[model samples]
Target: MIIKIAEIEEEVVFSGIICADRFKSDYENVDFFGPVEYSLKIGRSDKRLSVKGHVQCSLNLLCARCLESFRYEIDSDIDLQLLPREMAPTDIDLELERDELDVRYYDQDEIDLTELIEEEVILNIPMRAICKEDCKGLCEKCGGNKNLNECKCESGRDTRMAQLLRSYLEEEGDGHGGSQEKAIKVKKG
Candidate 1:
């Protein structure tokens, strides 16, 4: 949905439901099977356009641990300042002020709500998603999903430590020459 700045007089309030399917191409990795309800108030103060809104949606995300798909709901608050390209500073080396973090520059007179919604949805997703707090994840050895089924692979020793111990025991005559010879003979026997 594109909001034309020219259409607005001084201030306007808009509220509608945007189909989540519209953002399917934007978020190819995740699935959105719900509508995004949004209510925004756009007002112009001098050359700056202030936008405040609320967006809510549901998403189907894959659990990072068990690799199972689950539904997750998102409700995000939108507070932004839209500045014209000419008013924005051109210096890339300059540090941004604290308030400038939420400021977005617009090259054209229209603002694309689709891009904004996509960004908010992606940002709201957790860094690491798990189906449950006690999710048992997959078995490293047998590649079995531990949450669903148990595996026979040994789970006590760390794989890295076991590899190191095996490498040390297989080394030929590393200081304990006689002990190494006896160990090799016992293995063959």
Candidate 2:
């Protein structure tokens, strides 16, 4: 996965497929389902290097809402500029130019493609993943998946509200006969 800068004369285009198993150790949170196929263009001018590429892969992600595992496909483009550490700006207070956002410094004569691919994949992942819109999550009362089954629990009332409601009903019925039983039936209904 290491790309040697010395191998490239001026510019070179390389294409390859990295197996899903190769990234398992590096990206433990992601479950890669397919190979990452990529095409990279590497260009070197004096001490500066530029890398541009396209990567494609499939992943298994868990939905944040329903907690179900689902497949997601990713096709992303990457562009980076590499400068020698010595060539980087020395001023700490200087504002970074717009073009410098994507710039990176390399201390060695090689680039690690594995780390690059891992970064790309991780960045493309959604901040909050859902299996589908309007996904019904698990029922809080019985721990039943609301998307798959219906539960008889009172799904709306909070525990604190229900307790306060019960106490209020008991107090209201203390001055009246048989009103507590009627109020209980009404609440259930």
User: Against the unseen true structure, what C-alpha lDDT does each candidate score?
Assistant: 0.69, 0.69
Q: Write the per-residue lDDT of candidate 2 for residues 26-90, one digit (tens) a residue.
A: 55346877688888888999778888998878777666556777776777787988877777776
**Candidate 2: segments with Cα more than 4 A from true spot:** 26-29, 93-95, 98-100, 150-189
Residue range 1-189, candidate 1, lDDT tens digits: 788777777888878888877677765457776688888888987667888897787777676667878776667788998887777775664427624568887778888877776687666756555555556677768888988887778656659888577446534313332322221111100
Q: List per-candidate RMSD values in Å.
A: 15.7, 15.6
Best by TM-score: 1
RMSD over all Cα atoms, model 2: 15.6
